[model samples]
Target chain A: MIVVGLLALILAFDVAHAGEIVALPNEEPSLVLQEPNECLQGNSYCAVRTSERRKFKWIEKSATLTMDWQTLLLRLEPGVFRLISGNLWVSPQKGQSEILTVETEAAQFSSRYEFWIRREESQILILSVRGPVEIRLRGDSQVYVLESGFQNWISRVDRRGRAQMGIPRAIDIESHIEVWARLFPGSRTEFRAALEEWRPIWLNAVGLSSEIHQELVHHRELAMAREHRSKKAQAEARASENQRLRELFRQKVLLE
Target chain B: MTRFVLFILCLTLALIEVRSYFHNYFSQSDRLRGEVGKLKERLARETLRRDLMAHQLDDFRQVVATLLPEALKPQRSNRADDYPLRNLATIVFEQKSLNLGLERAGVLFSKAKTHFQQGEYERSNRIFSSLIQNYPDTVHLAESYFLLAEGQFQAGDFEGSVRNLDAMITLFPESSLTGYGMLRLGKIFESQDRFEDAEVVYRTISKMFKDESMLVQEAQSRLKAVEL
Candidate 1:
């Protein structure tokens, strides 16, 4: 169970960073084990508060773990963030609830919203949302749902050169009804078209399906093989030519 | 019985270690979580401060634009011409609290001149035009017109250049640049093949400066070559 949880955390880290998953070199990343506690199976949640480098606090309750920590550091300013996983929901300090979801081939969780928080007095409150999961804030507490489809799926290019991938999560915003209705009429269509343009490049990079992509890979391989053979033949021909010239010179010398 | 005894002893040791580890781990994790929380707060405050500074800088630029003159006079810098004119304007841009009008005009003039040197003719022309429109009372009005003429020339708008040069010569007759302006007029007339009109301008320059400035000599040479 510990090993499985560690793997999931590593995968989550990969999604947050631009998909580089190797561990940092020459240093053992410190891992602190917490006592086993009941994990939230439904509507899992976590929150953190950071105060520029002086102190930090985290409270996490998920389908697999219930962990909380508070620590002090020299200073912390930019690039501090909070991440939570499992069928999650978020409630911001102000307007509509949100849900976030994460899906993978092995396991799937929906409505897993992540948020950052800042400390006020002794308590912390949400400041911003980072992941595509839904969020609900105060006043007009409608639940907004936004989730990423391909949060994690390690892909290796196959011999046939194709890979399947999912799309990023959608975002939900609620404004005055008139404004909202006016803005959303063609929003989905435009967004899908934009996604379609980027889909092929990403899919090929991850080794996914497409006849054109496969044909390109085949041509590249064939060209490489031909180049190798041509180079070898040129070397052999040069050797033969050199030997023949040497023999002819030897005969000419003997005749003289 | 012996195997069971050994197993019990191992279990005891494991329990002892596990309890102590969990106790220490939970305490340390709590401390770490608190630190991360504080860092987030600091980040928010710092970001807010930086954003406010940027907003203030933008506002300063707008105020400078509003107060600068319609025509800008160029100042020959004590610093070598190799230094960009815009750098001279930096002090004025940073002094927005002063509400001084002429200083801002100087900055705009410097910016226009820098743009012209960089081959951004359109931008330079617009800056010069703005100076002329905004600060007609400015002493640099005639200079602005002249600079605009130079911009038009660089952009292949010879007709526009002729109009602006004519305006500069008429508006600032007593201005120190009359000789230079007249010389430009001669060159323009020569380009149009109006050799007789060009000769009159060259003769006028010769009468104005008996010392015969280098520009007068060039104009005289061009006139003679045209006559031949």
Candidate 2:
């Protein structure tokens, strides 16, 4: 749930930043995260907002992470990312020896392999999809190691004003098939190919058979078509914005 | 008496004819011997030319062997299945080797440098590799190796960067760029948080070069930071 505050509108500058937009049909234009500048330092904090499109992207360079939307990210340290809301599916780049760190409202999640974290209602649900993940709850020094196919939850004491924590428990990974499809959606064929890299994890754990493989392909056409439409619209919007800027400049500067 | 004189003249004439025949045969034999000697010389020259051509062919084969891998090996399909229609949108190539231009090695080197400067590290590495593979004896070989390593580092290919840096240093120890290459290697070590390894590299660079005063100063400055 993205809250399009008045501050976002006020702080959103008219500068020509690439691939950024603030829009929705029923609500006010909700573009809050000011980004692409902070990530340039290579060792400092970088902030990014998930686009209003259907692209499940692996943010490249140092801290490469895969994600599905519904996120408002603010302040990312070298290894740590603070997810305000929505689910974040992160995996360290293949062969990279570094660990990835993600912080929620209550617990800090760190892992060398693939994991997912989502904030729902008053709790933060974390699912370790691939390897072991270390979860350190806020104000508690005890680090809980959650293995693969296990899920845990923590209370958002700061945000929701509720404190709840849960032990690691086994989860049905087959149930999360739709979730992975939605997140890494390009096509079933494509998704299956991408999953080859995580062969040891997904193939054995999920047991994705031919039937599930077919179901994954259903969302391909629609998502791609939607992505094309939105991207084209974004390009047009950027062009129109540029044109408007030129017109304003001509009227204001040249006329004056 | 007259009959005896005629018999004597006939005998002399016959003897003279025999002598002429023998002289003609001897002269012909000498001419044939001279021709055989000349033929032998021509044969020797042809054999030497053939041997030289064979040597040149061997050298050419050696040159091709360095560059043939890129041309022969198919590009890895990292995202071939990711987008089914991706081939229509992008260049799809397999089975065929990329263009090899040993003659245009200089032009390719400059292009690689431009790519590196523009921060297109992957593209830069590809071009540099082509140049290195095709033109092993290229004038820009040392720099190409250095830039290739540097580009790999930028592209987060730490292992490749290390291997390339080691190769460049080993191959071109006499080149002026070796000090800089070592310095970059030190930086790569530091990037991987191998602080002790980086300190050792810096120390080696500081100690190894007498004329490379600039590199020595840089290494010394870096040493202080790494020490801290």
Q: Against the unseen true structure, what C-alpha lDDT does each candidate score? A: 0.47, 0.65
RMSD of candidate 2 to true structure, Å: 43.9
Which runs in model 2 stand beyond 4 Å of their true positions?
A: A1-42, A56-63, A158-163, A185-187, A193-256, B1-228
TM-score for chain A, candidates 1 onward in order = 0.22, 0.56
CAPRI quality of model 2: incorrect
Q: Per-residue lDDT tens digits of candidate 1, residues B6-68?
A: 776676557557755775586564565557656654554465445445634643543344333
Second chain TM-score for model 1: 0.53
Q: What is the lDDT of candidate 1?
A: 0.47
Worst 10 residues of 1 chain B by lDDT: B65-74
lDDT of 2 by residue, A1-256 (tens): 1123422432353123323442323232233223444353475655554545433354544445655564545446667777765677776566443687887646788887877876687677888877888987764567888877667778743222223577455544564665677776368899888667654664444443334445656778778899999999978975674455334323422243
Question: Can you give the lDDT of residue A144 in candidate 1?
Answer: 40
In Å, residue A241's CA in model 1 sits off its true spot by 76
Highest lDDT: give the candidate number. Answer: 2
